[model samples]
Target: MQPLETRKDYTYGTLEQNQLLENPLEQLSVWLEQASQAGILEPNGMTVCTVRQGRPSSRVVLLRGMDTGLVFYTNYLSRKGTDTATNAFASASFWWAALERQVRVEGQLEKVSSTESDAYFASRPYESQLASAASPQSQAIERPALEQLVMDLRTNYPERVPRPEHWGGYRLVPDYLEFWQGRKARLHDRIVYKFKGGKWKKERLAP
Candidate 1:
Protein backbone atom coordinates (compact mmCIF):
# COMPACT_ATOMS: atom_id res chain seq x y z
CA MET A 1 0.00 0.00 0.00
CA GLN A 2 1.23 3.40 -0.88
CA PRO A 3 1.75 5.72 2.19
CA LEU A 4 -1.39 4.31 3.81
CA GLU A 5 -2.95 7.56 4.96
CA THR A 6 -6.67 7.67 5.60
CA ARG A 7 -8.36 10.44 7.56
CA LYS A 8 -11.97 11.34 8.35
CA ASP A 9 -13.56 13.52 10.98
CA TYR A 10 -16.16 12.00 13.29
CA THR A 11 -19.16 14.33 13.10
CA TYR A 12 -21.78 11.76 13.85
CA GLY A 13 -22.69 12.63 17.44
CA THR A 14 -21.52 13.24 20.99
CA LEU A 15 -21.75 11.10 24.13
CA GLU A 16 -22.54 13.43 26.99
CA GLN A 17 -22.80 12.37 30.60
CA ASN A 18 -26.31 13.79 30.82
CA GLN A 19 -27.43 11.54 27.96
CA LEU A 20 -26.39 8.37 29.71
CA LEU A 21 -28.77 6.14 31.63
CA GLU A 22 -28.29 5.37 35.28
CA ASN A 23 -28.04 1.69 34.48
CA PRO A 24 -25.19 1.07 32.08
CA LEU A 25 -26.70 -2.21 31.00
CA GLU A 26 -29.90 -0.50 29.98
CA GLN A 27 -27.98 2.16 28.13
CA LEU A 28 -26.01 -0.52 26.34
CA SER A 29 -29.24 -2.17 25.30
CA VAL A 30 -30.55 1.07 23.89
CA TRP A 31 -27.40 1.63 21.90
CA LEU A 32 -27.52 -1.91 20.62
CA GLU A 33 -31.05 -1.40 19.42
CA GLN A 34 -30.09 1.83 17.69
CA ALA A 35 -27.19 0.07 16.01
CA SER A 36 -29.56 -2.53 14.65
CA GLN A 37 -31.99 0.11 13.49
CA ALA A 38 -29.16 1.92 11.76
CA GLY A 39 -28.61 -1.17 9.60
CA ILE A 40 -25.17 -2.01 10.90
CA LEU A 41 -24.37 -5.62 10.16
CA GLU A 42 -24.14 -7.99 13.10
CA PRO A 43 -24.91 -5.27 15.60
CA ASN A 44 -24.66 -7.77 18.44
CA GLY A 45 -21.16 -8.81 17.53
CA MET A 46 -18.58 -7.96 20.19
CA THR A 47 -14.90 -8.49 20.71
CA VAL A 48 -14.37 -10.71 23.73
CA CYS A 49 -10.90 -10.59 25.22
CA THR A 50 -9.53 -12.99 27.79
CA VAL A 51 -6.16 -13.45 29.43
CA ARG A 52 -4.19 -16.60 30.09
CA GLN A 53 -0.76 -16.66 31.77
CA GLY A 54 -0.33 -12.92 31.18
CA ARG A 55 -1.16 -13.26 27.49
CA PRO A 56 -4.36 -11.82 26.10
CA SER A 57 -6.49 -13.28 23.32
CA SER A 58 -9.40 -11.62 21.53
CA ARG A 59 -12.14 -12.88 19.23
CA VAL A 60 -15.53 -11.80 18.00
CA VAL A 61 -18.57 -13.52 19.48
CA LEU A 62 -22.24 -12.81 19.00
CA LEU A 63 -24.04 -11.52 22.06
CA ARG A 64 -26.68 -14.14 22.86
CA GLY A 65 -28.31 -12.82 26.03
CA MET A 66 -28.41 -9.51 27.90
CA ASP A 67 -30.35 -9.98 31.07
CA THR A 68 -28.06 -9.70 34.14
CA GLY A 69 -24.98 -9.25 32.03
CA LEU A 70 -23.57 -9.89 28.59
CA VAL A 71 -23.88 -13.52 27.57
CA PHE A 72 -22.19 -15.55 24.84
CA TYR A 73 -21.80 -19.24 24.20
CA THR A 74 -18.83 -21.38 23.31
CA ASN A 75 -17.09 -24.61 24.10
CA TYR A 76 -15.78 -24.83 27.66
CA LEU A 77 -12.59 -26.36 26.35
CA SER A 78 -12.00 -23.47 23.96
CA ARG A 79 -9.15 -21.06 24.49
CA LYS A 80 -11.35 -18.25 25.78
CA GLY A 81 -13.21 -20.56 28.10
CA THR A 82 -9.97 -21.96 29.48
CA ASP A 83 -8.65 -18.45 29.97
CA THR A 84 -11.75 -17.35 31.84
CA ALA A 85 -11.57 -20.47 33.98
CA THR A 86 -8.07 -19.47 35.00
CA ASN A 87 -8.56 -15.70 35.39
CA ALA A 88 -12.31 -15.20 35.83
CA PHE A 89 -11.99 -11.72 34.31
CA ALA A 90 -12.56 -10.66 30.72
CA SER A 91 -13.48 -7.65 28.61
CA ALA A 92 -16.02 -7.33 25.82
CA SER A 93 -16.21 -4.39 23.44
CA PHE A 94 -18.54 -3.29 20.66
CA TRP A 95 -17.79 -0.85 17.87
CA TRP A 96 -20.55 0.58 15.71
CA ALA A 97 -18.45 2.45 13.21
CA ALA A 98 -21.36 3.71 11.18
CA LEU A 99 -22.91 5.11 14.32
CA GLU A 100 -19.59 6.46 15.53
CA ARG A 101 -20.12 4.72 18.84
CA GLN A 102 -18.27 2.18 20.97
CA VAL A 103 -18.80 0.43 24.25
CA ARG A 104 -16.39 -1.46 26.48
CA VAL A 105 -17.22 -3.77 29.36
CA GLU A 106 -14.88 -5.29 31.91
CA GLY A 107 -15.70 -7.54 34.81
CA GLN A 108 -15.68 -11.00 36.32
CA LEU A 109 -16.77 -13.87 34.10
CA GLU A 110 -18.85 -16.82 35.18
CA LYS A 111 -20.60 -19.65 33.44
CA VAL A 112 -24.33 -19.23 33.17
CA SER A 113 -26.54 -21.96 34.57
CA SER A 114 -26.62 -25.13 32.54
CA THR A 115 -30.35 -24.69 32.26
CA GLU A 116 -29.91 -21.33 30.59
CA SER A 117 -27.29 -22.78 28.29
CA ASP A 118 -29.55 -25.63 27.35
CA ALA A 119 -32.45 -23.32 26.65
CA TYR A 120 -30.32 -21.15 24.42
CA PHE A 121 -28.83 -24.17 22.72
CA ALA A 122 -32.30 -25.50 22.07
CA SER A 123 -33.23 -22.21 20.47
CA ARG A 124 -30.37 -22.32 18.00
CA PRO A 125 -30.83 -23.54 14.43
CA TYR A 126 -30.36 -27.21 13.83
CA GLU A 127 -27.20 -26.68 11.81
CA SER A 128 -25.70 -24.46 14.50
CA GLN A 129 -26.52 -27.04 17.15
CA LEU A 130 -24.80 -29.72 15.14
CA ALA A 131 -21.78 -27.53 14.41
CA SER A 132 -21.30 -26.59 18.03
CA ALA A 133 -21.51 -30.20 19.10
CA ALA A 134 -19.31 -31.52 16.32
CA SER A 135 -16.48 -29.06 15.84
CA PRO A 136 -13.63 -29.11 18.36
CA GLN A 137 -13.25 -25.37 18.74
CA SER A 138 -9.77 -23.85 19.09
CA GLN A 139 -8.22 -27.08 17.96
CA ALA A 140 -6.52 -28.36 14.87
CA ILE A 141 -8.59 -30.62 12.69
CA GLU A 142 -8.77 -31.64 9.09
CA ARG A 143 -11.69 -30.36 7.02
CA PRO A 144 -12.79 -33.82 5.94
CA ALA A 145 -12.73 -35.15 9.50
CA LEU A 146 -14.82 -32.24 10.67
CA GLU A 147 -17.33 -32.84 7.92
CA GLN A 148 -17.48 -36.50 8.82
CA LEU A 149 -18.16 -35.66 12.42
CA VAL A 150 -21.03 -33.41 11.41
CA MET A 151 -22.39 -36.12 9.12
CA ASP A 152 -22.19 -38.70 11.86
CA LEU A 153 -23.97 -36.33 14.25
CA ARG A 154 -26.73 -35.85 11.72
CA THR A 155 -27.08 -39.57 11.34
CA ASN A 156 -27.22 -40.24 15.08
CA TYR A 157 -29.38 -37.33 16.19
CA PRO A 158 -32.00 -37.18 13.49
CA GLU A 159 -34.37 -35.30 15.75
CA ARG A 160 -33.40 -32.79 18.45
CA VAL A 161 -29.65 -32.41 18.86
CA PRO A 162 -28.40 -32.57 22.40
CA ARG A 163 -26.23 -29.77 23.72
CA PRO A 164 -22.73 -30.96 24.34
CA GLU A 165 -21.58 -31.20 27.94
CA HIS A 166 -18.51 -29.13 27.15
CA TRP A 167 -20.40 -26.39 25.35
CA GLY A 168 -22.31 -23.73 27.28
CA GLY A 169 -22.86 -20.06 27.93
CA TYR A 170 -20.83 -17.55 29.94
CA ARG A 171 -21.96 -14.25 31.36
CA LEU A 172 -19.63 -11.36 32.08
CA VAL A 173 -20.89 -9.47 35.08
CA PRO A 174 -19.49 -6.05 34.36
CA ASP A 175 -18.22 -3.76 37.06
CA TYR A 176 -16.99 -1.21 34.57
CA LEU A 177 -18.44 0.11 31.32
CA GLU A 178 -17.35 2.92 29.03
CA PHE A 179 -19.40 4.48 26.25
CA TRP A 180 -17.65 6.36 23.49
CA GLN A 181 -18.94 8.59 20.69
CA GLY A 182 -16.92 10.20 17.99
CA ARG A 183 -16.85 13.96 17.64
CA LYS A 184 -15.36 16.59 15.41
CA ALA A 185 -11.58 16.74 15.04
CA ARG A 186 -9.62 14.39 17.31
CA LEU A 187 -11.76 15.29 20.29
CA HIS A 188 -14.11 12.41 21.10
CA ASP A 189 -16.52 11.76 23.94
CA ARG A 190 -16.16 9.14 26.67
CA ILE A 191 -18.42 8.38 29.62
CA VAL A 192 -17.64 5.70 32.17
CA TYR A 193 -19.89 3.88 34.60
CA LYS A 194 -18.10 2.14 37.43
CA PHE A 195 -19.86 -0.05 39.93
CA LYS A 196 -18.90 1.15 43.41
CA GLY A 197 -20.39 0.62 46.83
CA GLY A 198 -23.29 -1.35 45.30
CA LYS A 199 -24.28 1.46 42.94
CA TRP A 200 -23.17 2.76 39.59
CA LYS A 201 -20.98 5.86 39.56
CA LYS A 202 -21.03 7.80 36.32
CA GLU A 203 -18.17 10.05 35.22
CA ARG A 204 -16.70 11.62 32.13
CA LEU A 205 -13.21 11.01 30.79
CA ALA A 206 -11.04 13.26 28.67
CA PRO A 207 -10.86 12.07 25.12
Candidate 2:
Protein backbone atom coordinates (compact mmCIF):
# COMPACT_ATOMS: atom_id res chain seq x y z
CA MET A 1 0.00 0.00 0.00
CA GLN A 2 1.16 3.51 -0.71
CA PRO A 3 2.10 5.75 2.20
CA LEU A 4 -0.39 8.58 2.77
CA GLU A 5 2.38 11.16 2.72
CA THR A 6 3.77 9.78 -0.52
CA ARG A 7 0.87 11.08 -2.59
CA LYS A 8 1.46 13.81 -5.13
CA ASP A 9 1.06 17.37 -3.85
CA TYR A 10 -1.49 19.94 -4.99
CA THR A 11 0.01 22.86 -6.86
CA TYR A 12 -2.31 25.78 -7.46
CA GLY A 13 -2.19 29.55 -7.43
CA THR A 14 -2.80 31.76 -4.42
CA LEU A 15 -6.19 33.03 -3.27
CA GLU A 16 -5.27 36.42 -1.84
CA GLN A 17 -7.45 38.30 0.62
CA ASN A 18 -7.90 41.44 -1.43
CA GLN A 19 -9.10 39.34 -4.35
CA LEU A 20 -12.14 38.17 -2.42
CA LEU A 21 -15.53 39.84 -2.49
CA GLU A 22 -16.75 41.60 0.64
CA ASN A 23 -19.72 39.25 0.73
CA PRO A 24 -18.82 35.60 1.03
CA LEU A 25 -22.01 34.71 -0.77
CA GLU A 26 -20.82 36.70 -3.75
CA GLN A 27 -17.51 34.94 -3.64
CA LEU A 28 -19.31 31.62 -3.56
CA SER A 29 -21.36 32.62 -6.57
CA VAL A 30 -18.24 33.44 -8.55
CA TRP A 31 -16.60 30.17 -7.61
CA LEU A 32 -19.72 28.27 -8.47
CA GLU A 33 -19.89 29.88 -11.87
CA GLN A 34 -16.24 29.09 -12.50
CA ALA A 35 -16.84 25.51 -11.48
CA SER A 36 -19.73 25.28 -13.87
CA GLN A 37 -17.73 26.73 -16.74
CA ALA A 38 -14.92 24.32 -15.93
CA GLY A 39 -17.27 21.38 -16.55
CA ILE A 40 -17.35 20.20 -12.97
CA LEU A 41 -20.25 17.84 -12.58
CA GLU A 42 -23.02 18.92 -10.21
CA PRO A 43 -21.41 22.19 -9.31
CA ASN A 44 -24.40 23.11 -7.22
CA GLY A 45 -24.16 20.03 -5.03
CA MET A 46 -22.89 20.37 -1.43
CA THR A 47 -22.44 18.09 1.52
CA VAL A 48 -24.75 19.17 4.30
CA CYS A 49 -23.46 18.32 7.78
CA THR A 50 -26.06 18.17 10.48
CA VAL A 51 -25.87 17.20 14.14
CA ARG A 52 -28.25 14.67 15.62
CA GLN A 53 -27.80 13.80 19.29
CA GLY A 54 -24.36 15.44 19.38
CA ARG A 55 -23.12 13.22 16.57
CA PRO A 56 -22.44 14.63 13.11
CA SER A 57 -23.93 13.23 9.93
CA SER A 58 -23.54 14.46 6.36
CA ARG A 59 -25.02 13.84 2.93
CA VAL A 60 -24.91 15.50 -0.45
CA VAL A 61 -27.84 17.66 -1.52
CA LEU A 62 -28.26 19.91 -4.54
CA LEU A 63 -28.32 23.65 -4.05
CA ARG A 64 -31.68 24.74 -5.43
CA GLY A 65 -31.64 28.47 -4.77
CA MET A 66 -29.53 31.22 -3.22
CA ASP A 67 -30.36 34.71 -2.12
CA THR A 68 -30.26 35.68 1.56
CA GLY A 69 -28.81 32.23 2.13
CA LEU A 70 -28.03 28.92 0.47
CA VAL A 71 -31.15 26.97 -0.38
CA PHE A 72 -31.74 23.21 -0.68
CA TYR A 73 -34.68 20.89 -0.44
CA THR A 74 -35.52 17.58 1.18
CA ASN A 75 -38.18 15.67 3.02
CA TYR A 76 -38.86 17.48 6.28
CA LEU A 77 -39.13 14.11 8.00
CA SER A 78 -35.73 12.89 6.84
CA ARG A 79 -32.85 12.41 9.25
CA LYS A 80 -31.38 15.77 8.34
CA GLY A 81 -34.73 17.39 8.76
CA THR A 82 -35.14 15.75 12.18
CA ASP A 83 -31.69 17.06 13.09
CA THR A 84 -32.71 20.52 12.02
CA ALA A 85 -35.82 20.28 14.14
CA THR A 86 -33.67 19.75 17.23
CA ASN A 87 -30.66 21.87 16.20
CA ALA A 88 -31.07 24.36 13.41
CA PHE A 89 -27.38 25.01 12.87
CA ALA A 90 -25.48 23.04 10.24
CA SER A 91 -22.52 23.21 7.88
CA ALA A 92 -22.43 22.80 4.13
CA SER A 93 -19.18 22.13 2.33
CA PHE A 94 -18.43 22.21 -1.40
CA TRP A 95 -15.27 20.85 -2.95
CA TRP A 96 -14.40 21.48 -6.57
CA ALA A 97 -11.28 19.40 -6.50
CA ALA A 98 -10.94 19.89 -10.22
CA LEU A 99 -10.33 23.55 -9.50
CA GLU A 100 -8.52 22.97 -6.22
CA ARG A 101 -11.14 24.98 -4.38
CA GLN A 102 -13.42 24.36 -1.43
CA VAL A 103 -16.06 26.39 0.34
CA ARG A 104 -17.34 25.81 3.87
CA VAL A 105 -20.63 27.29 4.98
CA GLU A 106 -21.99 27.20 8.51
CA GLY A 107 -25.41 28.52 9.29
CA GLN A 108 -28.83 28.17 10.80
CA LEU A 109 -31.26 26.47 8.46
CA GLU A 110 -34.93 27.31 8.32
CA LYS A 111 -37.77 26.11 6.16
CA VAL A 112 -38.34 28.50 3.32
CA SER A 113 -41.74 30.04 2.84
CA SER A 114 -44.15 27.35 1.70
CA THR A 115 -44.90 29.51 -1.33
CA GLU A 116 -41.27 29.39 -2.38
CA SER A 117 -40.99 25.69 -1.73
CA ASP A 118 -44.08 25.10 -3.72
CA ALA A 119 -42.77 27.12 -6.62
CA TYR A 120 -39.55 25.13 -6.78
CA PHE A 121 -41.26 21.85 -6.15
CA ALA A 122 -43.59 22.56 -9.02
CA SER A 123 -40.61 22.93 -11.33
CA ARG A 124 -39.08 19.50 -10.72
CA PRO A 125 -39.24 16.73 -13.31
CA TYR A 126 -42.33 14.55 -13.28
CA GLU A 127 -40.47 11.46 -12.17
CA SER A 128 -38.64 13.32 -9.44
CA GLN A 129 -41.87 14.70 -8.06
CA LEU A 130 -43.36 11.21 -8.02
CA ALA A 131 -40.29 9.69 -6.40
CA SER A 132 -40.25 12.31 -3.68
CA ALA A 133 -43.96 11.99 -3.13
CA ALA A 134 -43.77 8.21 -2.89
CA SER A 135 -40.56 7.44 -1.01
CA PRO A 136 -40.23 7.81 2.74
CA GLN A 137 -36.89 9.60 2.93
CA SER A 138 -34.22 8.17 5.25
CA GLN A 139 -36.37 5.12 5.85
CA ALA A 140 -35.71 1.51 5.01
CA ILE A 141 -38.10 -0.28 2.69
CA GLU A 142 -38.02 -3.12 0.23
CA ARG A 143 -36.96 -1.94 -3.26
CA PRO A 144 -39.92 -3.49 -4.99
CA ALA A 145 -42.36 -1.92 -2.60
CA LEU A 146 -40.82 1.52 -3.06
CA GLU A 147 -40.83 1.15 -6.84
CA GLN A 148 -44.41 -0.05 -6.71
CA LEU A 149 -45.40 2.96 -4.68
CA VAL A 150 -43.95 5.33 -7.26
CA MET A 151 -45.55 3.43 -10.10
CA ASP A 152 -48.88 3.49 -8.33
CA LEU A 153 -48.62 7.20 -7.65
CA ARG A 154 -47.80 7.80 -11.30
CA THR A 155 -50.92 5.95 -12.32
CA ASN A 156 -53.00 7.92 -9.85
CA TYR A 157 -51.57 11.32 -10.80
CA PRO A 158 -51.25 11.26 -14.54
CA GLU A 159 -51.13 15.01 -14.52
CA ARG A 160 -48.93 17.18 -12.28
CA VAL A 161 -48.12 15.72 -8.88
CA PRO A 162 -48.94 18.07 -6.08
CA ARG A 163 -45.92 18.82 -3.90
CA PRO A 164 -46.12 16.65 -0.85
CA GLU A 165 -46.42 18.51 2.42
CA HIS A 166 -43.49 16.51 3.82
CA TRP A 167 -41.22 17.39 0.92
CA GLY A 168 -40.12 21.01 0.71
CA GLY A 169 -37.16 23.40 0.88
CA TYR A 170 -34.86 24.79 3.53
CA ARG A 171 -32.59 27.78 3.27
CA LEU A 172 -29.37 27.97 5.25
CA VAL A 173 -28.93 31.47 6.56
CA PRO A 174 -25.15 31.39 6.80
CA ASP A 175 -23.40 33.10 9.68
CA TYR A 176 -19.98 31.82 8.71
CA LEU A 177 -18.30 30.93 5.43
CA GLU A 178 -14.76 29.87 4.55
CA PHE A 179 -13.08 29.69 1.18
CA TRP A 180 -10.05 27.50 0.64
CA GLN A 181 -7.74 27.56 -2.39
CA GLY A 182 -5.17 24.83 -2.44
CA ARG A 183 -1.58 25.78 -3.20
CA LYS A 184 1.79 24.09 -3.33
CA ALA A 185 2.99 21.87 -0.48
CA ARG A 186 -0.48 21.94 1.10
CA LEU A 187 -0.09 25.59 2.16
CA HIS A 188 -3.53 26.59 1.05
CA ASP A 189 -5.24 29.92 1.48
CA ARG A 190 -8.18 30.19 3.85
CA ILE A 191 -10.53 33.17 3.87
CA VAL A 192 -13.46 33.35 6.22
CA TYR A 193 -16.49 35.55 6.65
CA LYS A 194 -18.46 35.92 9.82
CA PHE A 195 -21.80 37.69 9.98
CA LYS A 196 -21.66 40.19 12.84
CA GLY A 197 -23.06 43.58 13.74
CA GLY A 198 -25.51 43.37 10.86
CA LYS A 199 -22.64 43.10 8.39
CA TRP A 200 -19.99 40.68 7.28
CA LYS A 201 -16.58 40.57 8.93
CA LYS A 202 -13.95 39.08 6.66
CA GLU A 203 -10.75 37.53 8.01
CA ARG A 204 -7.97 35.15 7.17
CA LEU A 205 -7.19 31.91 8.91
CA ALA A 206 -4.23 29.54 8.98
CA PRO A 207 -4.08 26.99 6.21
Q: Which candidate achieves the best lDDT against the true structure? A: 1
Expressed as tens digits, the lDDT of each residue in 70-115 for candidate 2 is 9999999999999999999999999998888999999999999999
| Model 1 C-alpha lDDT per residue in residues 71-149, reported as the tens digit of each score | 9999999999889888998999999999999999999889999999999999999999999999999999999999999
Clashing pairs in 1: none
> TM-score of predicted model 1?
0.97
Q: What TM-score against the true fold does each predicted structure earn?
A: 0.97, 0.96
lDDT of predicted model 2: 0.92
Clashes of 1: 0
Flag regions of model 2 displaced more than 4 Å: 1-6
Stretches of candidate 1 off by over 4 Å are 1-3
Pick by TM-score: which candidate is best? 1
